[model samples]
Target chain A: SQTIHQWPATLVQPVGSPLSLECTVEGTSNPNLYWYRQAAGRGLQLLFYSVGIGQISSEVPQNLSASRPQDRQFILSSKKLLLSDSGFYLCAWRTSGNTGELFFGEGSRLTVL
Target chain B: AQSVAQPEDQVNVAEGNPLTVKCTYSVSGNPYLFWYVQYPNRGLQFLLKYITGDNLVKGSYGFEAEFNKSQTSFHLKKPSALVSDSALYFCAVRDPRNKLSFGAGTTVTVRA
Candidate 1:
């Protein structure tokens, strides 16, 4: 059985503060990792995806950046956060190769004030 | 580019009556469809997926979906509705570009 874990279930930070959200997966290796954000009354937006270590594909231009430091460890970071950066952040992992479904982690809710 | 469309913003159903939440999709290759449910303040839960053979895919919580190639639709259905079934339902398609293009979710309200 595989499970995804994200930290800082809820966060409150001042504007322009640095941000870091971590996601790790257990029971799977070489899984494709993704980061998605959901705003209020909006659909999930793909932010970044990593197919392998040191290789990441960013889908949107934003203040956020993602890194795959280890095979199963992904991190979303921002040097300076803005009010627009506030939202629910989700991390997901899918099997390598051609797979449709993505197993998501319990999201991290960030409130920028 | 593959994409999904959930036409309804909300669906109201009476308990014990059949319910259908509509979905339509567009993909380049064979469409791999999926249904997910999100409870309030919770992550999306996987319901079902259509990959290869069967058109009628059954999933958790007594939910099922039918894949239609000609109509380009995959509608989620259940024989009877329950109060606990009320939640936000999302329709998705595999972009195969390693992304799941999801629809703006539909909120289903099961009236007791």
Candidate 2:
């Protein structure tokens, strides 16, 4: 059984501080990884996705960036965070060549104070 | 490009009653539809998907969805709603470009 892990479970940081959120998957290799953000407890917005190491695709232009340093390890980072950058960040994975069902992690809630 | 639309923002249902969350979608090719549930402060959980044959697809937690190609709709349904069923439901369509587009999501409240 494959499982995804994300942390820190919750964070509170001041504006302009650097941010880092990590995600990792076990029991699977070369799986597709994705980052999504949910704001105001409503809609979800795609942030980034990676098919392989050192490959990242941005869905929207924003203050955040993602990187795949190692297979099954993805990190979301920002040099300087803004107040608008606070939200619930989710990490998900799906097998390559599959239809489109994704397994999601518990998620990281960031509050930019 | 593929996109999904969840018409209702919220749905209120009594426990043990039928529950339905409406969704519609648009895609250039055959649509791949899916349903996901999210509890407060938790990540989205895959509930069901419609990739092929059957118009009705059953999934985890006794939840199912009906894929109506004619109407371009895939609605999530449950015969008996439980108080635990109260959560956020999302409808999604797979983009041919190897991504997925999610709807605005519907908040289901099952009152006991």
Candidate 3:
């Protein structure tokens, strides 16, 4: 079975502070990883996706960035956080050749003050 | 552009009644539709998907969705609603690159 893990579970950050959220997948290799953010009562916005290590495609231009340092490790980072950056950040993975069904992690809640 | 549209923002249903959450989509190529559920402050969970073959697809938690190509809709349905079924539901369309475009989401509230 494949499992996705995301951490910090929850965080409170001050404005202009750095942000780092990590996600990892176990029992699968070379899977597609994605980063999504959901604001209160809004749809999820795709932030970044990676096909392989060191390859990332950004969907929205914002105060966030993503990196695939390893085959199953993906990290979402920001040099300086903004108040608008506060939301529920989710990390999901999908099999390379499979359909669009995504396996998601528990998610990280970030409150930027 | 590939996109998904969940028309209702919220749906209220009584327990033991049939529940339906509407979803429609627009995509260039063959559409791959999917449904996901999200609890409060939790990540989305895959409920069902419609890739091909049967128009009626059964998925986790006794939930099902009917894909209508002519209507461009894939509506999630349940024979009997439960209080536990209250949550956020999302519709998605997959692009050729395997990226999923999600809808705004519909909140389902099953009253006891």
Candidate 4:
């Protein structure tokens, strides 16, 4: 079975701090990866998606950026975090197929003080 | 512009009764609809999806959704509700590039 792993399950940083959240997929290759952020009482907002290594499509313009360094590794980074960046960060992957549901990781809760 | 609308902010039903969470979409091409459930503090879990062929698709946790192209809606349904089903439900539509556009989500409170 495939599994998605995200690290630093919870994080707290002051405004203007650097941010880095990692996500990795297991038991699958050549998958499409995505990054989403969910604020309190709000639906998820798509941040970025990667079709392959070095190929990323950004949906929302914000303080965050994402990278697919490997087939199964995706990273979300920020040079200077803002208080608005505080939210539940989620990473997802789907099989390289026409019809595939997104599989999500446990998610990281980031709190910017 | 592709989008999904989950009309209701919440739905309430008693245990063992029928339940529904409405969803509608607007897309140019064929609509790929999906339903996902999320518990508090947990990641979203895929419930069901309608890709092609069948209008009625069954998925995990005894949940199902009916696709109506004419109405441009894909509403999720279940015969008997469980108290454990009380959680947040989301309806999503796949865009032209297979990207998902989700609604604001609906909270289902299945009272015991």
**What TM-scores do the predictions have?**
0.97, 0.99, 0.98, 0.97
* Cα lDDT of model 4 by residue, A1-112, tens digit: 9999998899999999999999999998899999999999559999999999999999987889999989999999999999999999999999887585798898999999
lDDT by residue (A3-101, candidate 1, tens digit) is 999998999999999999999999999999999999994599999999999999999999999999999999999999999999999898998985569
Q: How do the residues B1-112 of candidate 2 rate in per-residue lDDT, one tens digit apiece? A: 6899999999999999999999999999899899999999999999999999999999999999999989999999999999999999999988887788899999999999
Which numbered prediction scores highest in DockQ against the true structure? 2
Tell me the RMSD of model 4 versus the true structure.
1.1
Model 1 clash pairs? none
Q: What are the clash counts of all predictions, listed in order?
A: 0, 0, 0, 0
Can you rank all candidates by DockQ, best first? Answer: 2, 3, 1, 4
The second chain of candidate 1 has a TM-score of 0.98
Give the DockQ-based CAPRI class for model 4: medium
Poorest stretch of ten by lDDT in candidate 2 chain A? A94-103
Cα lDDT of model 2 by residue, A1-113, tens digit: 99999999999999999999999999999999999999999998989999999999999999999999999999999999999999999999999988879999999999998
Instruction: Assess candidate 3 and give its lDDT.
Output: 0.95
A best-first ranking of the candidates according to their lDDT comes to: 2, 3, 1, 4
Task: Let me know the DockQ for model 4.
Answer: 0.72
Off by over 4 Å in 4: none
Question: Tens digits of per-residue lDDT for model 3 on A7-96?
Answer: 999999999999999999999999999999999956998999999999999998988999999999999999999999999999999989
